[model samples]
Target: MSQNGPKMNEFEASTATEIRMDASRSTSVFLTIYSDFASAEKVWRRFEEYADCYAFQSFDFLDVWYRNIGHRSGVEMQLVVAWGAAAKPLMILPLGIETSKLGRKLVWLGNEVNDYNAPILAPNFGDCVAEGDFSRLWSDILDTLPAHDYVELMRQPKMVGHQINPFTELGLKLNASGTHMTQMSEDFDTYYDEKRTSKAKRQFRSRRKQLNEIGETKYVHPNKVEDIHASIDNLVALKSEALKAIGAPDFLAQPGYLDFYKELSAQSLNEGIGHVSHLEVGGEYAAGNWGLVFKGRFYYLLASYNGPKFGRYAPGLQALVELMRWASEKKATLFDFTIGDEGYKAEWCEIHEDLYDHIQARSLRGVVAQSLTNGFLLAKRTIKQNPKLWALFTKLRAKLANHRDFG
Candidate 1:
């Protein structure tokens, strides 16, 4: 192992403990662990082409992540590209490595912005590859890891190929991550016709009519600079209102974070992966979501609102419906509602992906550290899950966060 590079752990192919027995025998694998995105261009682009098929997996997002977070955080990125003899890439996992108590640990990159993390594989691989491809891939990863004592897989959404069941079956402790999802059909009419109850359809129609009566309600899906900036403003405003409604600190209230989002918007737009969808009533913007559109899919990244004026019409829902319809028309395969399984998302989406917050601790010190971390998370989840305890827990967290000056 080079001084700056990760240590290598040699293991035999058949006897490797990490090798998943479920994958097919014919699948050949190639692995490249990167210290940074700039150095991992060849691998990043290879898998990203497959990732771009999903709207949430835009190139600009990966770029923003490289610029704002990873490089500054001293985090090492790992690029694993599993391919066949033809050298065509099959699965790509863009992972970040962090030093823990035991040794170095691996996780998905950009956890701060991206709601979900999963391997990027060509759909065609799904057909030709054997059943145990995932097992073989992990076996290779485990064998290659030298200095790492733990592998932490974070926020892998459900329904994606990397199912948690198999990992757990493989003896890795699994944590079920919290997230939300929404599904969109070919068009609004078709969606209503096939999925919605008559009452729900009528209610939405009534709301639309009411919104129209209030003033000219226009749906804006902006992909340019001027419109994107406007959408950012709305997103900030809505985020503030939403946070206040729940008596929580506004995330975008922090100048640094807001600036980061602004920079991301500019970069995403310039890179042709930016998306800003809004519902403007009369001359005022009611609500909007600023995310990214990769390939044809739409990622509902962020949003804001004009509380009192557009609250009745559910401007947020309107924007989502409009954007989803547009994406469908554009031949998008999915509309990601993004992280957190909120009530609204349950009503809108049919798909539910499971993501795990994983931590691996091999050494004694690592075990102690893992216990502390996992204990805190477990306590937090307990409080958050109970409605009666949530308010008190929130206040406590807020007070601690304020004292810590979390940014």
Candidate 2:
């Protein structure tokens, strides 16, 4: 722990709530909160194995994200570990503190970019956390941290594998949008036929024909280091341009964001967590898609295609189709489009899983913050759900972008 950071002594002094499971059960549950990331890293892997952990929660991914983005943004780490009397880890809640417009808030690590968030649970321990246990846990968590406005946990899945998510029992609000995913079939043809209507399939075939006429198109996943770097660079450039064209804030404009993805791509290639796929037209890059493969699931993360030159051929859609086919060929059980409500995603997805957000106030100031934040989120959701309002918002955003660019 850093010299200025909270110490174990401080944590013990602040909150030391003993959790009892049941009268018949002899073991007692205890909580340990750490303000430093290194302490949490020591037990992270072992605890991760106790439950069904997502790739986003892996130490590698979160550490990288924090080092690159979170730390720079002045977010403080708060890792909560629960253990039984036998010294066995039960659950790991990777959380952090940051001062937002609402006030000082405690949130899950990777809350900004992660699609799914939940407390890492021990195997078969999901249903074990009852409301009483959670209430105690929540209180203990608040006690460990400095007085804050709200505890906001967002983008949590309702289930982890076969077990129910214990957090859902705590009564978090349903997120405005849910994640979209498709169950992959045994073969590409079967998956494609199942996802697309006859008309859509015909249109896809026509698009392919047009693309072929332009040049020999090939789908490739770069394996060589140089090739991967080049592909990632191309993706960054394309994505930056696309964001600029639409008048939206360019997330990739920051050097740290670019470096994060580049490092992620390299590390993912090394660890076999994911890969970057590209579509080449006449041996020249036309489109790129980066996705992760974990536990027989393909997670679509980032994708972009060539500009107006290749727009007519629908290179983006073509690349997505090729990616789906690749996932099917690999026998992936699911193709998760992550979080979005785009029309194209709905066309392919059969499963729409609700993500959730939890907001709780600890103090009077927190209640005010919670109310303001809730109202803001509700208004934002209302606008997003209304097509006309969303369209107008986008046009206004684009005009603002243009003014900013030309000013």
- Expressed as tens digits, the lDDT of each residue in 196-300 for candidate 2 is 899988887898888888789899887777888889889878988998988877887864777677667777667656578899988888999987777678899
For model 1, residues 140-198, the per-residue Cα lDDT tens digits are 67666555656666555434433222233243333334655455555656764776678
Q: Model 1, residue 43: what's the lDDT?
A: 51
Highest-TM-score candidate:
2
Tell me the lDDT of candidate 2: 0.77
**Error in Å for residue 385 of model 2:** 1.7
Q: Tell me each candidate's RMSD, in Å, in order.
A: 6.3, 4.2
Off by over 4 Å in 2: 1-17
